[model samples]
Target: MTDGTDARPVQTRRNLGIDLLRGLSILFVILNHLGLRIPLKKTALADVLPPWFLSRLNYNGYEAVFVFFVISGFLIAGNALQRWGGLERIDLRAFYARRFARIVPCLLVLVAVLAVLHLMAVPDYTISRPGQSLPGAIWAVIGLHLNWYEGRTGYLPGNWDVLWSLSIEEVFYIGFPLICLLTRRRWLLVPLLVILALSMPWTHAALRGNEIWQEKAYLPGMSAIALGVLGALLAARSRTLPARTTALLGWLGTIGLMATTIDGAVMWHLLRDGYMLLLALSALCLLLACEQRQRRGDWHAWRGLDWLRSWGRLSYEIYLTHMFVVFAMVRLFKLAGGDLRLGFLWYLLALPLCWLLGAAVERWLSTPCERWLRAALLRAPAAADPRQPASVAAD
Candidate 1:
């Protein structure tokens, strides 16, 4: 189950439930993008479905990114805790190297591809107002501030704009290790995470009028990440809950996730712009259920959902590359004289292509590069950590 070269576990280390959520989240992202390109109209299905329900189904892409953020925090914290025994004791160099190895290559390739598209004047890949950007979109991508750049300079193309989430995520990953070391004591780490979680409302509130910042601000995203970290710590320390208890937690979490993720979710005064805490806590509930299953060694694949699990495992690849598929497919749909009535067919064709592209990238490029970089950058631990049996839901 271990990859001997890098000392990381192989696919068997993958947790099924976690992958399922990841898969679902990425799919939501794609669905949202598709809906935007060719919006759902008064179809037979839409007519039959409740208006709110249809609306929720259409615009969940933004919420799905928050789901991914929570997952990222959980995986990173859980992995570090398992490997190093404590966050304070983490090997900073090894952590940085592994993260860099996994993240940088794909990023560079994405930027390079964007450059080519910009040169060719591809409609959805070209930067907007390059003059105002001073250096260019590449600078924002490299600086891990794409979200901020967009906030200041208006939007980039669809493919590049998607990197905004990456900026938010990478910023956390970059700072996480240092924060862990700084707050070595468990008491301090616990409260710091708590404070961040509690600050979610204010964080979002602070960005009140600014539409972009209201949605993609750093503090708001970090609040969710903080909740995820807390969830990991909680799951790692607690004993497996009883079957009924786990089920209850799972149901509660699932409902919360759906509430937040579904477009036009019930609005509260304090959470007008975002629902960071609710989404994170909901995700945490599911994580707790998944963690319990992991501990009980019953984390087997749910039959008929293997495709979703694969998507979950490939979430990172799919997330980064899917916009390319979306843009191309939409263009083709338009060229083929497609209309909103044919949107479903477009999705049917385009989704598989997205999966195919993501899978190919993983198999041919990212996976190999990740392995090589980890082997080169991360030193095998002094004592091999026991093949970590569970609780790694993955990033």
Candidate 2:
């Protein structure tokens, strides 16, 4: 289907399995928010679904985000290698131009809407905390440290709070190219990535009890990206796995992913801070398997997952704008006297609306703005180096 895992610039062709993983991860984010805003009770969903399956379906947002971190790292790094020939050969200005074009348009639109909403004194949209202000939040976002601000002052409104992950992603990319540049000079990039990623467990452990820091901190999040980079480097150099080996990895990934979701409470108790690291690693394995299988063009196209495929394709837009639909649905549910009986129905409505909003934003805003900015900003294409080989498509 050539469905890419991220809203990125370099796309020769994409793997279907990667799209499915992205789709699943974003779904987790939505379900997590839905459960957070209006707590899903046993009385609501347990009547039809089994307790184990229902448990898996609830509050999977954070783990799903880790999956994204890995996928994003894998795609961006793999694409860079395909485009520029090597990480060290990366062009800093061109890399930044492409990133700025793709990311900033939607980001600015989101924050502008948020600023207007907060100014209007909407219920859930307000920066109600005594310590938080509109200007401060905006500055934090600009500085790529929104996560730090939230850790110190407490959570912002739902719409703004989602930017925590973006903060982590921004900072990681800021360093990603720089690290690649350093590899050209003298330092070994592979070992450097390894050392940084190995430090992830300690980063997670250091702030184990701090809820905001654990989820939003830079080191822990960047580590996942590093692991993903390593995965890409490995895939670029390694031979494809045989069918049996691919099957084994596929089973391992599916079981581990499901266990983390379905028996989340159990995994939480067993792994604690290690839970996130485990999730990221499992994602790494699954993506590698998908990459190998995809190269052979041997994957089955499941018609039932087309909706999720759409979600994955528009994941970047959906991730930013879905919360607006969520809050609106919450408000409507409140007008309905906040009945739990209707909570499930709100989810059904919210998902399609999120898809619609995401589609509209992509068609009207993100894509057009990206094209305009790229034309204005770039003197040369980001992918072609002329000195390097042509960009190759990958999972």
Candidate 3:
């Protein structure tokens, strides 16, 4: 039932729930970005939306990014654990190559295109800061080091705001595999969970007052990832839980998410601690629910949602690239003397445009580049096998 390593080709078909969640999250992210432009006026649409919705929307789009991280943890860690016996069977070289192939090509292309736009003195779009140089920005985006620096200040350099989440993903890419490699003992999972629980308070306390904490606390965000990894471990080791229990957990998880949203809105600073715990618990519950559905053979099937799942598959691209497109759109609108006012109609128009641009990048540029890189990397090792000394002779 896994996507990556199952002997059978993993179903490329989309799961309805996952896709819907992904699309919803991406939409929220866009709204959040747009909201940043409009002030919180009493008469505005921002004032009409529930405080919970506003809380969930932005402030660096943490909610969406958090959902993404949990899903990645569930899927990636689950795959790693399923193939655990093949611990030695892992192709570290290929694993890294695949990771690079998946991420780098689309990113480099976007960076190059953006750089060209910057140089051409494109009207209405400004890329450089008064004191910051283009080479530094280029280096930051490419190296993924920008998150640490840019996150410290509340300022994002132009259209590159989305790079922060990509930085977290890159960190996970390095850390999660190593965790699987090192925590081979079955008993280690317990200690890992314990350590994750213990680390949260420290993370919250250390980063609480600092604005950068919003970004730097990505390490604390690993708690949810650990929750997902724990779910995978359970799935790998145990049969289905009681159906009633699964249903309860699923409902509880949904409720937890709602409660977290409400609490975040009404008592944000007061309930911050409890809200963080709830977010982690909610994500864990979701993982449990998905596992239960898989066991029951109740696969999600719906055409519209399947399309969302396809977008989820390309979410990394959408997440990383969408901000640039959005900023560009805003600049264009501004130059055309369009109002910066927020409204249902403006958001409605913007949503489809963002999705369309994301789809275009995924199809025309990202997907093909990823495919070529993967094919080249996978083929290169096989093609060069003759160059290796015989294992028997070396031994």
Candidate 4:
């Protein structure tokens, strides 16, 4: 739905497949974080728990974030192409306004809260280094430099550490629109993005020894996003494939994705090096299936995945605030003499709490502020200018 302020014609019809994938990604991210923060090994049930399941949980967060990056590239690039009719006619101002509206509101609120908690000397929010002040942390986050900061120094606390992904994403986006506008030849853009996407694996291979570099490099994340752009471009051009073929691709992609995500032992250097790219390819395959379904008007097929769609709608908020829930639950467990059983209970409760907080932020704050600010920033198109079409101008 158009939020009236950004002047861009927003796609109102929700894609159930995209939502389902996004929802699944966010769930994977939460589970990964839980595995890290909670001492589940200390619990009585640890011995009985399947080792495979535990390994799967810990290994998938990076892949999930990879999915998210790809999806962002697909959706953002697709929208800009659709609105402007082509990259040659893209309106950078409108793009920035929409991005600002969608991203800034919730992000600023989260940063403010984190800063306050750090200032209050909360253990969970405490600075990781002696010289690094709260203001510096806040500045890095706002400036989208958290990834660089963490790579140079160590990590920030739980909530702040998550900003590394956000920083990488925003920085990539800062260049996305300009790059699109600069390239007059549309075909060249796809090939260029593909080249970058392919280069990502080599980049990762080059950084093999550095833990921080491997964990939070912009190149790796950007590579995923580039693959996403390639996916969108191909999907836009291709006709719907046979349902059986699409289904096979989807299943193969999903299985490969799951297998690769958990295989951190590096049984083979080639497979390990290519896994990130494979994960993006898997996501792309699924996205292609989703696109085909949309092309065929198969909305009824989404009946079972409604919860995924709901989670997808609130995915951003859940991602930003879930760390708070994790930190709180961890602190409470410590206060109560560190009962490991509480980890299970907290995990159960935290899921719903995250949904509630995210929904509240989206409804009461982010949505309204975006609507108002976008409206203020973007002006309606002038009817006299045929060259500057209504679709290209904001509101």
Candidate 5:
């Protein structure tokens, strides 16, 4: 009896739930990175928890990265679908231009800054040891080849280890649009999703007990992205749900996510693959439920979380810049002869520091770069009409 138009919104606001989740994920990432070298034997939590728990909990930063991938895929794919009708008609140039503008400039700046810092702080460090020059370190970072020497070199120069994730993202930035362009058939998407899901386990098994596996895990970690695309597709196809049902699903999804995290350690190796699948599903379900609830005017509104959401909005900048602050802290602690240990207190201190650095970089560096890039990309005549207006376009 109801018309299709009644089921959809005329305009949609930003989803606060996603913002909150992203913010929380970034916080976890900072904690994980900061705690990497903390002696687990010294901590009560580590003592009480099983090895499985420690491993899973310790690696939760990777999970946060996966969640970001999902959000990216969902947002990007949703936009692509709306503009191109299944990607067949996508404007590849504009897509690539936008992606390059958003990612490359900041990345280049970070690499340059790190390079300069490495030169100033440790003039002797190099990609090759004993006789090589510090410029080798700069070359490794700028070329995104840090991972190649990570195992042999012990540590990446100047906290550039985190750039591995950025490298994976860059690869995706180049490849994902091509994927969409090549596989425009709707039927192919589901199969492609299945392949991505299957490929992770296969690749993991193939690379097990290998350092290369750990370094390249980000590339095979496309399952979350696939889940996000699925969520967007579901949103496009389905109607809003009843308020009570939406609320129930939201709670269920949240519980599932927590359970997945807690149980992930216990289920490591044996159920790691299953855990990822379940986590992605739970996140997707939560997103769907939240979307429905928002439509039905039943979504939760947390004022304190707005700050977190704002951080999430600037997460890319934060993620890219935090390494510099962490490296400086590490050096300071070393100079003071202080033991590097992970504790709740360390997180309390580091989190704020990371946020402050992120804010400063975003305000001073990323924002201006973004503005310039946007202006450049939006300047061309073809770019302006990359897609037809929705009003005049046909479904």
Candidate 6:
């Protein structure tokens, strides 16, 4: 996407592989939450299923989110770099507008819905703290400090807890563009980002005993995004490599990503902090491979992943709203005598329902509001510049 900028690079179509990764990420999050509600130790499926299979299904949600951070960093940083050529020419107002449009509309809807649900006494929606009110929860989330608040006070109920990631991401973004803008040389960003990338594991090692470090620490997430930035930089320069070499790196990355999810390994225990860093690097490799394929005009070769493209397109909405599906399913399970075995079946039903809900939110609210807001913002006298073009789509 461009903002009528002369520096804008030639826009490419969305890569199916990125879409598929995003789709899988959201699906993993939903399934992970669903598995949490189900008492796996008491279920027949748990008994019959291989341990490896259960571990993969139940515990990989965080990994999927790691995928999202890298992907988001790659895309967002790539977009900014393309638009301004360097951060010096960047339009901070337009950049903020783009993000606000993409994120705020759906978030407002989510907050409103949850507030209503909390007031109605929906299970798992009630305020957890003695003195806290619904507006207290709402303001904390709106301020994007909910992660810190939760780390101190306790968790918000159910899906509201998902806002923690959003809080961390937005906080990171607050400094990302500024850092890029302030650096006098493009190469300087490497050292800056590298330090940020390493900060997570360092923090983890130093603060292993701290609950906030264990729970809502923001540096790890920033590290993942920074790694994506590094990946994007490498991808931009890798167009000269033979396709075969790039493809091999891509496959290796894919394998490494899958290997990180395995539960029974000594490697998992020994490399706990570095494990996520590896996942981010693998994601970067996959992204670089996709960039190579895009350059080769074969990025869309995988038609089987088209379904995932739809999921990826709506990933933001799905991520925010899927908890509603989770809460409802949990309530239904309770009404049905709380049978843990039935959770698998309920999870199946939730998948489509969450997709449908996300689709509707995108079609009716988020997409339109984003388009209108961007258009309006660009049209405003203060926002307009004849020297620059209109804003273009990012992905």
Best candidate (score: lDDT): 2
Error of 5 at 241 (Å): 2.2
The candidate, 2 or 5, that scores higher on TM-score is 2
lDDT of 3 by residue, 1-395 (tens): 32233343222323345555556666667767866653223115555676445545544256666666666666655555443333323446555665776678777887787677778877433455454555766787777666665655455454666676666667766765666567756587557765774465467666767776454456666765666666666766778788788889889978876666545564347665556666666866776776676667776467756666555555666776666656765666667665544434455666667777777876787666656765577664222111111110000
lDDT of each: 0.76, 0.78, 0.59, 0.74, 0.62, 0.74
Candidate 4, pairs of clashing residues = 1-12, 5-374, 5-375, 7-394, 7-395
Model 1, which residues run further than 4 Å from truth? 1-12, 42-44, 130-134, 269-274, 379-395
What TM-score does candidate 5 get on C-alpha atoms? Answer: 0.79
State each model's C-alpha RMSD to the native: 3.3, 4.5, 6.9, 4.7, 6.6, 3.8
- lDDT computed for candidate 6: 0.74
Measured on C-alpha atoms, candidate 1 has an lDDT of: 0.76
TM-score of each: 0.91, 0.91, 0.81, 0.89, 0.79, 0.91
Quote the positional error of residue 116 for candidate 5 in Å. 1.4
Candidate 4 TM-score over all chains jointly: 0.89
Q: Candidate 6's residue-wise lDDT over 2-71, tens digit each? A: 5443457535456666777778888888878887877444466776887567657776787888788888
RMSD in Å for model 2: 4.5
- Candidate with more favorable, higher TM-score: 1 or 3: 1
What lDDT score goes with residue 101 in model 2? Answer: 72
**CA-RMSD of model 4:** 4.7
In model 4, the worst 10-residue window by lDDT is: 386-395
lDDT of 5 by residue, 271-324 (tens): 765666667677777777766765676666878678897767667778887766
For every model in order, what is the number of clashing pairs? 1, 0, 0, 5, 0, 6
Q: Write model 4 residue lDDT over 241-292, tens digit each, in one string.
A: 8888778877877776666666645523557678778778888888777767
